[model samples]
Target: MQLFIGNINGQFGELEAEETQHFSRVLRGKLGQEIYLTDGKGTLAKGVVTEIHNKSIQLELSEIQENFEQRPYFLHIAIAPTKNIDRIEYFLEKATEIGIDEITFLKSFHSERKNINLERCQKIVNAAVKQSLKAYVPKLNDLTKFTDFVAQDFSETKLIAHCEEDFERKNFKEILQPNENYLILIGPEGDFSLDEIKLAEENGFQGISLGHQRFRTETAALNAVFGLDWAN
Candidate 1:
């Protein structure tokens, strides 16, 4: 079922402007019509359209499912944005649907795109969550430089998904422990530079190979998300 995200304040299930438009114009929702709302924190609320104004709508929540489809562990991926915006957008949508917890854009040595539209990407994430009927919305971090990102503290098993064969790497499947929090680093189209790889390793990130076949930055990130889910 198509779902909408509601504001989380003193009262729950407050429809935002776009959602109000979607319900009032596109869906032609009637008064007292049953609708679903999500708080994007693993809570799903079933409500009915109670008030419909020219540019607004209010829902009276009747039921709620807390911890809806919660995953065993958190998976956060820091990836270099591809040159093409569509690829990053696709990754955001598909990964959210597949249950990614957090996404961080990296500006590595070989990164083609240094920036992205945060607001637009967020909308894509929200739309994907609604489309997939998920209550949790993945967090999208601002674009960060590779050096600064690596220095940040992460308690989980940190991994750098690189393609170079010079260094010995662990197979992703074998290293992943069930229900363990993870923070993976995926390089861009040109992959991480040798210095970048060395820096990551020095910062507690183990080299991890996605597979024998090379994958794009977005593909590797998306694969990591699914791989973690599969491992759990």
Candidate 2:
């Protein structure tokens, strides 16, 4: 099915500018042709191409389906933004495709990148959601300090991925409880400092290993995502 992204709330609506390009140039949607749209908020609406303009296309909704079985549990990944912006973007796209509810770029003591292109990241995730045919858009939160992020009241199974060999960690399969919200922490290239790790532990974030192999920040974040998917 050709899935477009838009809102058809009151019987009629128009595709957003970014979506208009796909409607005309990529999909070549024709008037009267049936199309599908998701608000990326769990609602999928069936609509027909009503009018094709130069830059925007009008749509009329016919039917709507709400997704209720969106992952029984929440998987929120909080990771330090990689030095290379592309690396973080790669992780964002892949993780969104795989399935994620929330993502937060963190500012860590060892982190190289302080801020990320919020708008760009949003577009990447939005495109991934449509490409992967997902109804819910994984939210991209503002960059947060490591200590501040961990201190917040989060889901039951809060985990922090680290490369320290001395730290006691367990496989997610052995620790994760199904159907409960989860918040995972992934550090940067330099990894988390001893103090930051301790802070997380104090905040009830358990140490979790993504296996023995050392992984980059992006890889570790994606690994955490797959780990939760497996547990689910």
Candidate 3:
């Protein structure tokens, strides 16, 4: 089914300028063609085209379905932005496709890149949601200090992914529980500092390992996402 996106209240529908042009001039959808519209907040509506114009496409809702499954519990991933922005963008695309609740870019001591293009990241997320046929849009947070992010009152299950020796570590899949909210910390290329891990532990974040092999920033983030899906 072709899914279009709109705001939460379903007041105004949105289509990219290109999409509007294509639907009007290229595909030429008729007035009665059925289409699916989503608010990106778990609300899906079955709509029929009412008008196809150059600037906009109008639809009349016939039926609506609300996804009330409680979102499979929240999965919030905090990671350092990669030096090469493409890798982080790729991770965001795949993570959204696989179903993550929120993403935060942490400013770490060992982080090489300190800045992120929010606009570019949002575009990637939007495209991924359309490709994955998902109803909810994952929340994207601005870059924040590692210490500050670690100190927040988060979900019940909080984990820090670090490659340290002292702490007793388990694979994320082993630690995660189904139907419970989770927050994971993924570090940058140089990984988290020993002191940072200690601070996180002090703040109630459990240290967990993705696996034996060393992974890049993006890989680690995606691994955590996989772990969450497995647990769910």
lDDT winner:
1
Candidate 1 vs 2: which has more TM-score:
1
After superposition, the stretches of candidate 3 with alpha carbons farther than 4 Å from their true spots are 8-32, 52-56, 68-70
The C-alpha TM-scores of every prediction are 0.94, 0.89, 0.87
lDDT of each: 0.87, 0.84, 0.81
- Return whichever of 1 and 3 wins on lDDT: 1
Report how far off residue 27 is in candidate 1 (Å).
1.8
Q: Give the per-residue Cα lDDT of candidate 3 at 208.
A: 93
Candidate 3 or 2, higher lDDT:
2
Worst 10 residues of 1 by lDDT: 6-15
RMSD of each: 1.7, 2.2, 2.7
* Candidate closest to the true structure, highest TM-score: 1
Candidate 1 lDDT, tens digit per residue, 1-232?
A: 4699876442446787888888888988889888788888988888877788876678777667889989999989898899999999999998998988899999999988988899999999999999999999899999999999999998888999898899779999878898899899999999999999999999999999998786877888878888887888
For model 2, residues 62-121, the per-residue Cα lDDT tens digits are 677787238878888998999999999999999998889999889999998988889999
Angstrom error of the Cα, residue 187, model 3: value is 0.2
- Candidate 2, position 219, lDDT: 84
